[model samples]
Target chain A: MDAKVSTKPHEMLAATLSQEMAAVNALIRTRMASEHAPRIPEVTAHLVEAGGKRLRPMLTLAAARLCGYQGEDHVKLAATVEFIHTATLLHDDVVDESGQRRGRPTANLLWDNKSSVLVGDYLFARSFQLMVETGSLRVLDILANAAATIAEGEVLQMTAASDLRTDESVYLQVVRGKTAALFSAATEVGGVIAGVPEAQVRALFEYGDALGIAFQIADDLLDYQGDAKATGKNVGDDFRERKLTLPVIKAVAQATDEERAFWVRTIEKGKQAEGDLEQALALMEKYGTLAATRADAHAWAEKARTALELLPNHEIRTMLSDLADYVVARLS
Target chain B: MDAKVSTKPHEMLAATLSQEMAAVNALIRTRMASEHAPRIPEVTAHLVEAGGKRLRPMLTLAAARLCGYQGEDHVKLAATVEFIHTATLLHDDVVDESGQRRGRPTANLLWDNKSSVLVGDYLFARSFQLMVETGSLRVLDILANAAATIAEGEVLQMTAASDLRTDESVYLQVVRGKTAALFSAATEVGGVIAGVPEAQVRALFEYGDALGIAFQIADDLLDYQGDAKATGKNVGDDFRERKLTLPVIKAVAQATDEERAFWVRTIEKGKQAEGDLEQALALMEKYGTLAATRADAHAWAEKARTALELLPNHEIRTMLSDLADYVVARLS
Candidate 1:
């Protein structure tokens, strides 16, 4: 992975993000400590200390540094954003009833669903407290809006699950809500807190949104064909759950009458038998849906790179652009 | 009820709460509207329009007003606190798999559990946004602490569920988190935002905390003997669930060897069957557990009344004292 990003074009970008991410991680650890309840520390540490890439907080830190912020509040803001992201994940695993996340047993799986829900709530409260310390109403506004958008997105995804009629438009809305809203807000609030120009703020939001969308699209694409060991998720899990992901949706759009009946039974109604996985894989193959999904991810990555044109030519800007590309390059 | 309030001091307290609560209801409806998402309005209206009593927010308003606050932010603060309370209720229903709230179908039951969780999250985000607009870090501190306390209380409750060994300390910690933290924070922030003296703010917090503890204990007591029509909850519901409520805890503490064995079999081993409710009721009566629980509630109510000494006497203060009395009067 380091070798891939160490090429002349990507190395500088990766280096900047790596430095900023270290600062974000330190801030996360500092804010997650609680004086009142031992369980608060234990539960939050279980998730925060799990060693996933601090992607969301790094977005905030990078956006703030890129916008020429010199203050320390950005560090706190970045941590706040990360806490919210982690809190959502803790709750999401319980809601999805998944057993694993990032190759480890989910907090819910290890502690119980109740702990996941309550501890998630604790992190959310902690996040709000961290943001409030910044004392910027605009920062709070952007983050609170992001939080609501994230929730709305999750709700949309839940409603869309198992519904075969779920189209690209709804899927896009769900992805934007669940994934992109926070990414955009994470970066946007960094700019807002730093009192950046409104146009630059817009650019930052656009950059983050496009990057997050691409990242999620890549994740969905990988779900179909990526190595299970690398991704930390079982292959065909989405298919088994009958999730109407992009690949499945694209294939369904191009299915014949007989194929449509097969999907209606297997995906929509969830009446799959032993041989259904093979049939599903064959259908995805015939329509080249996975390839199409990868192409869509690349398209979004390119759009993210295009948004960076509005930023001044700085090392951070260059790295952000490379990061966008790196998000999709994993597929290639 | 109106006639009774005119004739009885306890009834007068409820009437005062009712009037104060109306203002809270109006504010909640006004704040919940979002111009961007029609779905937010649709989902929020389902719960906001469900006719809750608005007790928590009223506590904030009454606490502030009684403490000589002459500011307008208390209204927003009251509304924000209520939104947080409502959001938790929405999520809790999903977590507990509960079907009913306030004698009506829950949002999770009426819509979907996903909607309940996500919409609840939206409301929570919105609440934080509202608090930030108040520009008081003290208010934020009070509320943020409350949120964590609430979540911690919930996790404790979940851990204690079905474990008959859950003692009074664990039960009190759970009750404080689940119920008293918000009640205290609502009042504490009310005073803090109003720029009340620090001493008065502490007193208000004590008042609310004691009142909340008393309120919860009263409700638990009522669950064993409340009128089905008035409480809108089925009698012996907690018994059926084998909840380690105060009555059960006290009863177990006073149980004979044979009675202890029976409780261990039914509550700990989960061997509840038909006629277990009557047997449990008999045990509670024999041990005077219900009376002991009522005594505890009365003591808390007295403590709440004592906290009001810091505030100047007013009609609202008098009403608050009466409210404290009324909370315990329900046990009779």
Candidate 2:
């Protein structure tokens, strides 16, 4: 435990906050069961026990503790966060027709699309029940908005996919809706439920927002430069899927006539062929878009770090700041 | 309006509650939209404006008025109920792989599964936001449980399919989880938000539970017997799908060896052949289960009617009682 505490931001926070996370895990286990539908627990257990880092919920616990909350609601709120995230992941896998997640077969692959969609919904409803238990209207408002925004972002991506003109503005909007909204809500609710000052709550929200954007940008960048072993994803999977991530979007914006024709044939039309991925990589290098996307991620990480200064000085504060650095550190 | 009020229970309720229903309609129209994801509204409008009777929302509005609610929160609650109902229909169409609804193509058939699932999710999140706006924790608890129950019911149905061992108890449990739970929630929240007495709230819950069960049983029976034009569904669609609804469950229990072979060949093995739907229908008649199922629906309808006697009487009370009768009246 001592060796791990100094190794990673989230792991250190988890080690420091083990007891509360245990309570959150227990709450998640208890609430996920149904008297009539035993299938729910089976599907949920497949995903929840898939050995995720539980980073978002830990953020909630860490934020609440750092803000001096000596109460119990944070556990419920953290569980809510995890449930919402897990629900979206389930639905997302179905939507993406994904076969694997985190080096294992996705829930949709194991069961079916019907199970994934309905079980995702069950978890979402379960999440609302959890947040309501927190008894904070402000917390409800944050999470509710986050949920809507997450759906909206996903829908936006659906409409925007395979289109050449989806710009950076739209890309950021999608990121905010799909990824950052929950992050901000998870952190904001921690401060809000703790009855922290409004400025601190706002600071927490900003910190989460920037951190999530950085995390997503870093992820998109890693899809291009990341190791299949380290990231547990085949490199160029997004390219193969024709997804319009940041690196590709940047490369598209800078494409010459020949390059634009290549993208249109390969991406817009999805007529990808042998050596096309290599050609796409060559064009990206020509545009230096990988470096540019990496820079953008670094800047967002810096923004996240800056926002942490507004938070009250505490041990968790250092962890959160380090967490921001760790998000971009993945790119390095 | 006067002409309409005397024609049917739903028409009567609509005529009596037109003004308030208008507000609920307006709220639904405004809230189902998204500035970011216009597809949200497009998909919702396809389902919401398809001209089905807004029965669940009417239950909320009717229960509120019967309980002497003169405030506006009922509109939010009613809208919440409709959003939840609509959200479920969208997801249900996808799960059932249904092509049509209320004589119109389903949103899943018209758009795509991703839009249906994500838009359904957006509507659910919007429902939670609407319910939260009512400022009633009791209402939240009731509806959240209903949402969870709905998903659980659907998942239960998925697991219970193609299995001959699924009995009447499981059928009723599925009915309660999927249909009656929402109906009960719609009425219970109406009373709870009005600050009505606990007994009245319990009565409303009982009324909705019975009504929804009756309504579902009636629907299953209709699928076998009703005119295709009147029901907007081809007769025996459930049989074709090999779904083990209540009507078939009852018949299967009393099946002779020869009848069991037919069921195994058609339903369990799904090796459906010519005259199989007709054969299934003939077997149902031979066992007298259709009439027996109809009798069960009437009993539930009568139970719904009986539950209303505990409520303080109002004009809408009569409409609700008649609505219970009308739910099963279609079977005749």
Candidate 3:
């Protein structure tokens, strides 16, 4: 840890890669423009400018910098990662029928679903173009596959999200496809562009993959108990939406006949009523599912930390490891 | 035109590259599947198995073969083109709120908009992965830009479709963006994979571009006057949809004040009433707008045919040139 700074791990990583992050931000602005379609830039600017941590792009930049890279392709790769992340966020809002994101009205709600869908497609194309400029077919292969995996994960979630029969394994698969795939690709491409050693590149990929899984697990858990002011997400939103995240899945697996009927009435039939959210939390606590889910998140975070040992020792690597801890730490 | 056979140009092109077309179809079938997300293939199969002619992939194969490409990469490139085309069609159905496609229910209608959007995205990602496997960065650059242009065109059409002030130039830009971009990419990548000279590649691109424009124009005109049984489209469908196609643009240019009010009510304000279609047709007849629109289609078809003369002498070349003529000849 940096004793002189009170910054969190993600904020510390962003500060360390501030110059590269600035380049990525600028490139995102430059590339999202359309000569004929002004709505594209308008819609994109609303979401892209609605500030988040830019964690995915920072991972790319940090991996490259930690590998002692001196070339400029890392900037392009960082922007590519951000574009892919942003594109998914756009489409996810449309698929989830979400109204709010990052404490603001989502692009879909403000503009329209058509704008969100088309602009998301535009960003995907822009990301591919950016990656192709890197001239590494290997990098293209990784990102392209990541994109497919991300979409596949989303499709799986569509079928698997609300169904009471969806198991923990399916939930894990969905998370890996939608969340970790991009994280690994983002970090792997960074190392590949820097011409890092195979071992280090694989390490970066592992670090990102585990960190993303832990991060998602924590996020899902937080949705039930998190301070809405801190997370900017309304607790019980997923329950209201009938999403079968890990905690609910764990609780459902242990449910009695009566409790199962409650799940069916609420999640499957969408017959939610007042006090249902409280009852759902009571069931989760009855089965100790929240504690179990938190344990899984910690395990994934520890795996992420352990993966960093394969990389060459660096300050960025330390930050990445702590970032993993910070992911699960929020829930605790 | 070939003197011996009684087949149309597209059929001739397909027959010549039958094996390659089969391979492309098989590759599409294989690649569209997701082990975890069976919904991806299920949705894609609804469109892929809809029995529409594999025109775009055939163009890729024909161009590659005409340029004497004796490699397997063309098959991959052809599948890439088809996937991209299919992906766009899925998204287009959602954006246009279209129910029917090729006389069958669209993927969006058969499933849901979420399936259409996410599966279209999956196919797009799969297309990029296919193109990347070709190991040609130039091809990636071309296809990626084309994808962006296609999305931009769709966005433009969303705004331009209802506005009476949208001119022919804007309509042409939309046509180029939505349809011609993919056609040009399909043919350009074909010749590019063959390692053809820059001039021949340019010729292939021009041929695809002009042919796509002609094909779209003919289809639009067909919606006004052609046999709905043959075209699988209702007469005046675009009019009812408030689309500002070429014929409407032409008539609107020559509209009298009363006629302008009619268009403003029907198209701009979307206060369409009965007898609007008959009056619109009579207005077009008064202004010779359909004839003018037909002339534009024929001009583009001729431009396409002329561009093919720059390619080497081959049977496939004859079929492609004839394909240009056939694109407009259907309207007659």
Candidate 4:
């Protein structure tokens, strides 16, 4: 097939589901407005309309459409997913004291941290309201569990981010909490709302879980080896922040005594000298951790593609399969 | 009837519902624990096990028992109400930059703002899960709406707390959002779980709403006039903080042109001299706003008592009625 060079897979998914995405957008706008608190819509609009890919909501829409859903509730669920995502971003900025997000001033910077925290809360309540409107106890259960996992994952990451004792298992748990939990919940609810069979729902969940892990792994890898222009982040940003992502976790697992001392000084103690970033990169390369990390991303992407085979083949399905590949395609 | 000076009305309610309150406490402790994130419990325990009045959850338990609820779900709902209350308190401390709560170091102060924010979110999500377990859509709706109201009220208060245009209605709206929404939801969900008559359910909501308003007004009133030793706060903390509570709102409304300038300088611009608190108090006295505000508290408390007339007369109901009067009993 001849490729359209300008368009991405998510863009194709958006084109195919433009009508439903529009409904989701409209619902998001309407729901984000506060009758009393005008500050709500301002902060929410800044994040929601910041040209985010809307990838999570599209997963919901795509999975539902793939399962032959014709109902309007999928739109509500999509909006719910996006609201949850936006709420977290607002709080994440506050937690991280981030000044920029998606190449714009974060809500915490534009407004006060108080506004960011409370408005993030308002979005969370709004998301809960949206999910409750679905009238599906099963959907509520999934989303609520996802919410807990996401929160727990965040707390774990906060405590574990710089700890050298954080192994691969702990890293994966944090990854799932911060990223994959929502992705899987987003897709799982799509199949759930469509009343798909148990096996199909499980498959949908596997697809999203694998896809999100791959997405996050690729993101972390890109922090070290990615083009700054394409990734919109400088090389070694995560290393500078002292975050122990997959590549570092992999390298740390095989560090020598001297190397361990270096990890402790830089990551645990947060004492960095000049050339630390280069040294960290060299260590990862010495252990082939970055390449191994890239292989892990591709492996997860493969799992995501394989999971899609359980569902009916359609235009959306094909795009979703390609989207998985696209998430890891930048790794090289 | 002879008065028991040893116990407060809430204490009496606690004595009457001891078994159920134990269950609620247990559920809270059990649910607040995170298998992965130790920080979750550390932050939550700092606030939850802090000697808070637990008055909101007691409202849930009292209302449930007052309506003769037999099931165990009320405990879960009561825990859910407390979780929501605790979650808000955690966020509130962050929003307020509070150093202390319940006369102890606040969770935000004890931990970083990140832990407070994320743990508060964990509790909120846990509350959502507990409510979902109830399987009552109506119950979930009340709590969701309450959560939204609570957040909106905080946002509204953030913007309107110092604005001179804030009037009695806006004060009431802010009060309802921050205080009464949970109180009413606490009670409403109780009656809901009991399958009580709609009239009784409405009465439960009305009782809680009025009681919460009266409770907040009395607290605010006490801030200006109560014993600092008993209230654990210095007089004029609100005025010092430039908060536009009921007393300040009333005084601002009746202020003359020169007095309006005083308010704009003091509350709006947050400029205060040594005598500003004295001057503010004098303005309230000049307009009889303190007396008038006391009257409003009494009126709301009376409304709370009147609402209870529709509920069945039981030990819990009587205690609840007295609880309404007890809220305003602090006023001179």
Q: Every model's DockQ, to 2 decimals?
A: 0.44, 0.76, 0.79, 0.85
Better model by DockQ: candidate 1 vs candidate 4: 4
Candidate 3 per-residue lDDT, tens place, B162-241, comes to 88878998899899887899999999999999999999999999999999999999988999999988877789989998
DockQ score for candidate 3: 0.79
Candidate number with greatest lDDT: 4
Best-to-worst lDDT order? 4, 3, 2, 1
Residue pairs with backbone overlap in model 3: none
**For model 1 chain B, where is the 10-residue window of minimal lDDT?**
B1-10
Q: Give one digit per residue, the lDDT tens place, for model 3 in A144-208.
A: 88988888889999998989989988998899887899899988988898888899899899988
Candidate 2 docking quality: incorrect, acceptable, medium or high: medium
**TM-score of each predicted structure versus truth:** 0.83, 0.95, 0.95, 0.98
Q: Candidate 3: which stretches are off by over 4 Å?
A: A1-6, A255-265, A271-279, B1-6, B256-258
* Stretches of model 1 off by over 4 angstroms after superposition: A1-46, A68-71, A161-168, A223-240, A245-296, A309-313, B1-46, B64-72, B110-112, B161-169, B223-242, B247-292
After superposition, the stretches of candidate 2 with alpha carbons farther than 4 Å from their true spots are A1-6, A254-259, A273-275, B1-6, B255-262, B273-283
Would you list the C-alpha lDDT of every candidate in the order shown? Answer: 0.82, 0.90, 0.91, 0.92
In terms of DockQ, which candidate is stronger, 3 or 4? 4
Q: What is the per-residue lDDT of model 1 for residues A217-332, given as tens digits with 9 covering 90 to 100? A: 89988888989988877778888888888999998899899999999999888998998988988999999988999999999999999988887788888888888988899999
What tens digits encode model 2's per-residue C-alpha lDDT throughout B226-284? 99988878999888888898889998999999999998888888999989998898989
Q: Which of 3 and 4 is ahead in lDDT?
A: 4
Model 2 / residue B274 / CA error / Å: 4.3
